[model samples]
Target: MMIVTTDQVAGYEIVEVKGYVKGSTIQTKHIGRDITAGLKGIVGGEIKGYNEMMTEARKLAMHRMVQEAEEKGANAIIGMRMQTSTVMSAAAEIITYGTAVVLEKIN
Candidate 1:
């Protein structure tokens, strides 16, 4: 399936607007990783553990959003966006959402 951040896709015309579709997941920090991250923070550097976690979370969230779009019979998703929020002291929620639509190639 094709996904884009724009309202329109090049070379394809939107045939059907399937409405809004969303997927979300909550991730909590591991204590071991937290300690390591804390140390890295003190030294002012990238935290590998958190980076890996967030990368995985984004992939999962995007996959789930795609699944939802497929269930809605959408061949593409437009205006795709992702957002994050701290849900608790150690947990964060990541959400992916967009407009589901069917696309036909322009000849």
Candidate 2:
């Protein structure tokens, strides 16, 4: 499947609009990692643990979004976007969204 952040994809024409598709997940920081993050805050540096967690969250969310698009019989996804927000202390929500569409290659 092809994915783009814009409304149109190059070398292809959108034939059918499959509407909106989205996927989301919520994650909480592990206590051990949180402790490490708190200590790192004192020195002010990148939090590897938190970084890894968020990275995995993004991958999972994207995978789910793609799965939804496949179910909708979409060959491409346009206007792909990601959103993140703090749901609670030590927890955050990750969301992936896009417009599912069937595309035909332009010859």
Candidate 3:
């Protein structure tokens, strides 16, 4: 499906607005990874482990959001956005949301 951060997609007209669609997932930090991250912090470098974890979480949330749009017969999603928050000391939540729409190519 086509997804954009803008409200409009070039050459395509939004025929129907199916409202907002959202998906979220919660993830926890691995203890081993946390230890590694702490060491990396002291050394002053990028935290690859946490970065990978959040990247995967974001992808999963986006997938679910896209699935919801597909289920509603939407061909595209506009105004796509992501939100994140820590659920606990070790866990965090990623939320993906967008406006689902039926788009038709403009002739």
Candidate 4:
């Protein structure tokens, strides 16, 4: 399915609005990785472990959002956005959301 941050697709017209669709995922920091991240932070470098974790979380959340849109027969998702917050001491929640729509090629 097509997903975009903008409201309209370049060559297609939104034919139907199918309401909001969303998906979320929660991820926790690994203890071992956290130790490594702490060391990295002290050394003043990028925390690869945390970066990888966030990247995976983003992908999972987006996948779920698209799956929900597909389930609703949406051809595309517009105005897509992502939000993240700490769920607790070690866990973070990532949410992906967008407006589901049916699109038709404009002649």
The parts of candidate 4 lying over 4 Å away from their true place are: none
* TM-score for each predicted model, relative to the true structure: 0.97, 0.97, 0.96, 0.96
Task: Encode model 3's per-residue lDDT on 1-107: one tens digit a residue.
Answer: 99899999899999999989998999999988899999998998888999999999999999999999999999899999999999898899999899999999999
Candidates in order have lDDT scores of 0.95, 0.94, 0.94, 0.95
For model 2, the stretches where C-alpha displacement exceeds 4 angstroms are: none
Scored by Cα lDDT, where does model 2 land? 0.94
lDDT of candidate 4 over 3-103, digit per residue (tens):
99999888899999988999899999999889999898789888889999999999999999999999999989999999999989999999999999999
Q: Report how far residue 38 has shifted in candidate 4, in Å.
A: 1.1
RMSD of each: 0.7, 0.7, 0.8, 0.8
Worst 10 residues of 2 by lDDT: 1-10
User: Alpha-carbon error at 27 in model 4, in Å?
Assistant: 0.3
Better of 1 and 3 by lDDT: 1
Question: By TM-score, how accurate is candidate 1?
Answer: 0.97
The C-alpha stretches of model 1 lying farther than 4 A from their native spots are none
lDDT of 4 at 13: 95
lDDT of 2 at 79: 99
Q: List the residue pairs that clash in candidate 3.
A: none
